[model samples]
Target: MVSSPSATPASALSAHAITAHMGPCAILHDIHLALAPGRWTSIVGPNGAGKSTLLRVLAGLQSCTGSVQLLGRALADWPRRERARTLSWLGQNESAADDLTVYDVAMLGRLPHQAWLAPPSSADHAAVEQALRATQAWDWRTRALGQLSGGERQRVLLARALAVQAQVLLMDEPLANLDPPHQADWLLLVRELVARGHTVVSVLHEVSFALQADDVAVLAAGRLRHHGSTQDAASHRALEQVFDQRIAITQAAGMWLALPRLERPAAPAPSAAAPVSA
Candidate 1:
């Protein structure tokens, strides 16, 4: 059973009776969710659980039967450029021109704020530099995207998203190619964003990292199993059950950890060979 939303400031984003379909296959059922402002919420689930699909719907990048609202306004009512400026999206394996320099790629994020066919303004340049620095990609600003490693490319993409300076960020697998240290850096960056009153919604496969968010939204088979504070016992139970009870959540070193609950194999069926009296 899903718990109600914990006490929070006005919601930054919300969806009501959200149902989505791809061809004849239903990707998401009637779902309702609200994300709080100035906080981080992680969406987690098994494979094919519609985590990414739901994110796309919230970003206004996908079509669905239900209503999605951004800051008390219907998403559909926002102008295209206004919507782009208000909500930023960083998709998994996002494609960009291989020839573009790191700085140029990140500058694309400023498009919504720039006048048509106009050169980037001082504000745009500053935003790009800040974003690159935040992602630790500033040193590689002069390099082409094709010249970077997968991890480096991912950082550049993240910088691009950060450059948008949007109030709400929707990230799908933002840690895809990040190593442990870089993943830790990403966590710090998210904390900073939340501290600054931005809303962050991420779909993360890393269960341990997901637990670090202010809230966890568990999905299973295109349905919302639970949505509650990470510290809530009900949230932990839903998380374990969604993974078939194959994991256990434990606290250690002042943080939560999702450890595997490995099952011991059934003692190999008494050797089928006829045992001779030795």
Candidate 2:
């Protein structure tokens, strides 16, 4: 389903002067960022900071004021079919018809590759099989989506996205409703994609998970506060400032961990040196 560009660019994605509004309430303000090819970038922010909104704008799912470029071309200039083949989006709480089998749901990703009203080719079948197996969702291929648990359904959705085999992938809050082990599996999947020369952008609420990304973009109050390499001191400072220093960062086992600062009761001050009037 992925589109092969005539030529690849130095940066896979870029956004400039993006501002989005929902019903006259601004959600993002003058955002500018560029994502490198074949790298993983995570967007992190406090709730209501418009992290997801910014992602939508980049994906062309949301109308906003600004320009987003993909593969050295303006995003708006791409044909719809070509765009679909070049970018795959996995949004939060994605839902499909409850009666659709997992296989059928995942096979929908092949739409971009299929001729209209034509039967799926062997290529489509192969892609779906690989995707399902990758996510370990093959075991339930014939099961209807409604029959699966939230985590299981999430896996199926992820498989569908993987089946697209896009050059650039965007996911919004993909970790929601996943257990710790499954979350780790998702992380591995992302790394494997990046290693294979796919660019990935995800919006993550988990600061620790975001820290594992190659780069992080921090947003606060609908504005971009910082965008830099994850290990950079400037990025860490932006994170703390955005969160009002409620969390602390510690490096352990070659990874950064975000832990909340536990509030403790203040001790009473001794009665003002008991007024021994000098």
Candidate 3:
């Protein structure tokens, strides 16, 4: 069933006419979005479509024009530590200190709540353990970041974000290195987070996976093309259009599936009367 904003608390994040530019290029232009608490929203588009830029702006990591409110207050008004406690961000290609163990990296999420010079508290330990287990990275907690495979490291990064237990989570290309099974696990984890009253906004390349979100926002050429429930007909049309009409959405096994167009093999050309000219 499509989740409605009425069912959630006031929006966790809101943006209006938000514009961001880098040098002479405008990465995001006049965008508006509202993320309800306990909902999952996916922003999707082709490459250079500004999906990542928008996430960064929403996370307050980039400078942008227009209004951005978090928890009903201007985002800029929040202190850094307070904002960190409210917003957890996972960038497209996150880097970790290679020497740090997975456990140490995940524990870093507690920095906003911890006293300076103090070690991790019991609550912090519990949160870290739960996050690790939730992301299925508990077994690799002792491994150094440089030792894990790409997919394993990605899971550990997700564990770190979850360990924050923030009200709003922003993730970009979160499924980059994950296999199908792990992708499914990630979806389940997102749903669990929303069920627990956390708000999630992710820039996802997988249209099928994005379609599973409570809401979908399609961007094209740095402009929002559609923003609404996944079940909306307009959302599907926008999804198809943004992908250059190569993707078709259909129902199978009671689930929405994105099917890509396959090119037909060309028939062999008839051979000219070999050597007829000779």
User: What Cα-based lDDT does every candidate model obtain?
Assistant: 0.93, 0.92, 0.89
Runs in model 1 lying further than 4 Å from the true structure: 1-9, 264-278
Candidate 2 lDDT, tens digit per residue, 1-278?
33456777878999999999999899999998989988999999899999999999999999999899998889999998878888999999899999999999999988998899999999899999999998999999999999999999999999999898889999999998889998999999999999888999999999999999999999998999999999988888888889878888889999988889887546678775665688
**Model 3: how far is 235 from its true place, Å?**
0.7
Model 1 residue pairs with clashes: none
| Superposed Cα RMSD, model 1 | 6.0
- What are the per-residue Cα lDDT tens digits for candidate 1 across 1-278? 01123544378899999999999999999999999887899999999999999999999988999999988789999999988888999999998999999999999999999999999999999999999999999999999999999999999999999998998999999999999999999999999998887899999999999999999999999999999999999999999999988899999999898999889535666758886897
lDDT of 3 by residue, 1-278 (tens): 11233344467889889999999999998999888767899999999999999999888888989988987789999999888888999997898898999999999888887988899999899999999999999998888999999999999999998888898899999998999999999999999888877889999989889989999989999999889998888889889898887889888887777899775546699978857563
- Candidate 2 steric clashes: 0
Give candidates' CA RMSD values in order: 6.0, 4.3, 5.8
The number of the candidate with the highest lDDT is 1
Cα error, candidate 1, residue 173 (Å): 0.4
Of models 1 and 3, which has the larger lDDT?
A: 1
Candidate 2: stretches off by over 4 Å: 1-6, 264-278
**Model 3 Cα shift for residue 215 (angstroms):** 0.3
Candidate of highest TM-score = 2
- The better candidate by lDDT, 1 or 2, is 1
What lDDT does candidate 3 reach at residue 14? 91
Task: Name the weakest run of 10 consecutive residues (lDDT summed) in model 1.
Answer: 1-10
